[model samples]
Target: MTTYLKDLTQSIGYLEAQVVSLLGAKNLASMRGKGKLNMLYDP
Candidate 1:
């Protein structure tokens, strides 16, 4: 029972990290897209 609980906790932490990184990647992509649009309009 104790080992199972430990494993569950670790799994949750790993999942949280994955979600954070995925969100970061999405934000980066959106920012890059906006930058490209700005460049297109500015020049």
Candidate 2:
């Protein structure tokens, strides 16, 4: 279970990075402000 969670977290981080690169920081911040982001992945 620990390994699974670690892999999942890593995957989520990678995906989030991709989204940030595609959307840019300003767009990401706007989405966060609108409460569109999940709290677990806030960082």
Give the best candidate by lDDT: 1
lDDT against true structure, model 1: 0.86
Q: Rate the local accuracy (lDDT) of all candidates.
A: 0.86, 0.82
lDDT of 2 at 24: 83
Listed in order, each prediction's TM-score against the native is: 0.67, 0.55
Expressed as tens digits, the lDDT of each residue in 1-43 for candidate 1 is 9999999999999999999999989877877878876645553
The residue pairs found clashing in candidate 1 are none
| lDDT agreement of model 2 with the native | 0.82
Error of 1 at 10 (Å): 0.4
lDDT of 2 by residue, 1-43 (tens): 9999999999999999998798887767776787854655666
Compared to the true structure, candidate 2 yields what TM-score?
Answer: 0.55
